[model samples]
Target: MLNRFLLPALAATLLTTACTEPPKTVAALPILGERDVRPRADGGPADTVYAAVPAFRLTDQAGQPVSNQTFAGRAYVTDFFFATCPGICPKMQSELLKVYKKFPTDPRISFLSITIDPDHDSTAVLRDYAQRLGIGDASRWHFASLGDRAKSFELANHLLTGVVPDSLAPGGLAHNGTLALVDDRGYIRGAYDGLNAGQVAALQRDIPVLLAEIDGRKKGVAKK
Candidate 1:
């Protein structure tokens, strides 16, 4: 028969072993889209470059010019919404705010809310919206307008793959309700459903992974 002392000691040893086990490895996030792909000159096979957010110049809520350069060397999350949107826009913003709050003071991350209704969402209008959202840091969170409705839609649909205009849809627009995660190189690394809590939670978890990847790349370049 097993001794009482041996049973207790064995349980303690099992608990200790479980506590000392190595952590499970986490998979890295994936780069998204194929817009940047190109055919090889040799015509052997097409080479695919990771899709990147292209350069753009737009006016911020402060009436300041903001461009892709504004986020150079930084990772950012982006979505499209109009000030007067009555449907998904508010939900999308609320979801995105969770992400913004997650990295409230982290300079390495930024957030962009681009307006699809540029004619209505001027700099002043964007400013008022920012105020309504209680956005305290204009530098970290920008409400911007492309100032051209067609171009805005193009950027939303083609570049960011987020929004689409719908005359019959509520708020005169329909969007994918996605929050795009862009890496430092401007490549899109992930896109999360802005309307779903579970997807947003995944986005929150993935941001740190992308940041760590950026740090790793920097360290590699330094070593070379």
Candidate 2:
């Protein structure tokens, strides 16, 4: 319901039930076709194109340096999370963990769990958090430090895709469980709400296709 990017829920339900196949069950994503999950940015005639990522440096869960440069030449699944959240964070994380395990042996893909509450979700806190979630592997999956509240908030607005931090008062910032797909060139290819198992599975299926596309293109160029 949060993401009406597809269609009205009633229509979606009707369409999904009318067709047995997952591809035909749902409508076309803003960017991906019924069967294709790889972002169609450069492919032309795809759903949409992504904007280039900006340059910025931050820390990792291990307190190491990380930047937009960090994601360059790599593909990954990214999401925003906080150490202390009650509403959808738990369920959302549960779903994301399913995705983390999906590509257990995938060397070409990585996972980026960016914490919105950087102040509370420090390196040690994030490390503990990952352990609690039973994340697959540290090397394959990572949690990034989003700097301070000011920078994190700004980045979310600029990127127009992540987080809504809260005030220290009564309630917290409104959070969404969307997982973003970033390409090897540091461009955002697509996004999905990780709270939905069906959507997550769809995303899992698409990642390999995107990787294969890039790899194939590289090979073709090398031959030329």
Candidate 3:
């Protein structure tokens, strides 16, 4: 009789404790890409070095050099497109605009749309294109053109997108509508299909997560 009563009481106490405990937190977004484990100089823990976006300078709409340094300390979403794209460009830009509108005034975020047809999409052309999209702040929403068409294609590859000159394709160029989310450290954290609403929604959800992790790191707070 004593054992039966004690077991029931113990079970009830355990159930109550479990119900009152705090909920578990969602873990931080994983840093995407191949990483190398290296020993720290301070002899603490081994550091994992992730692959980062290579440095390249692009001529922005304002004819300014937009390089990795330009986006220092800020997370940016980048996509490849040409100003004259008649097929997917318009749709992709419209989708990206959704993300831009979400953080238009956010100082921690920026947008970069690189033109694959730089020879045709001049600085003035890009500026007008941006204006048509209601983007007045070039610093925040940069429509940049890289004059070296081959280099531009190479850069797109680094962002996990492909760009090729196809006369049969729209605007005489072929490209994927991939929106890549890069962290402040220039690492590719996420990539989404700009043409797909569902993937874009995931991108929207992830941007804040990365931003929150960055902020927490700065404040010496751990992100769960």
Candidate 4:
């Protein structure tokens, strides 16, 4: 799993190594990922396409289908975790709970927790887990899995939170506590340290900025 700091480093790689610096603004968060330059159909400037998350099919706690379409027109916070995790999972989820409470009923927001130990965290188990966490709304918060360990890990990597098996690790798995924020367009807008309260607070602040950006786009208003 990649450390939280690695996200900023990955974003900074696009910058020149010279003394020059890009102007910083709070109105819009930077999109983080590899990109491609392509010719525009309008024959205008070439478009730079950031890597968007690929579509995936998952089963939620309620045994309902969950995919990118489930979050259409909404922004979501996602993390990788197993129900039996003995290390950072509890604290990470606790921090995420804070963000969830802030927008528990907001139709524009959602949460996703992808389990790497699907064999042990079946839909019934995940349903019990979400109930234990007091997350009663499956529509607002989804505890989902790909139903295969390898497939789950592969999907985690696609979401930028890599997961792997490790005999020495807690619960026989090694993964980071990264809370990834994805906008409605399926582009990653932010990544936070799930174990750090300050970073989580930063995530809380950034969510509204992202939501505002989404609203601006809907109204044909340019984002700052």
Per model, state how many residue pairs clash.
Answer: 0, 0, 0, 0
**If scored against the real structure, what TM-score would every candidate get?**
0.84, 0.71, 0.84, 0.84
In candidate 4, where is summed lDDT lowest over 10 consecutive residues?
Answer: 13-22
Relative to the unseen true structure, what is the Cα RMSD of model 1? 3.5
Write model 2 residue lDDT over 1-224, tens digit each, in one string.
Answer: 56685568778899879887655343222332123335575866655444555676767766777776666666777777778877777887888788778787687788877777777888888888888887635666787777687677666544434555557522386767778777777666667787888888888887877787667767887999
Clashes of 4: 0
What overall lDDT goes with each candidate model? 0.86, 0.70, 0.91, 0.91
Model 1 clash pairs are: none
lDDT comparing candidate 3 with the true structure: 0.91
Candidate 4: residue 78 lDDT (0-100): 95
Q: Candidate 2: deviation at residue 85, Å?
A: 1.2
Q: What TM-score does structure 2 among the candidates reach?
A: 0.71
| lDDT for position 129 in model 4 | 96
RMSD of 3: 4.3
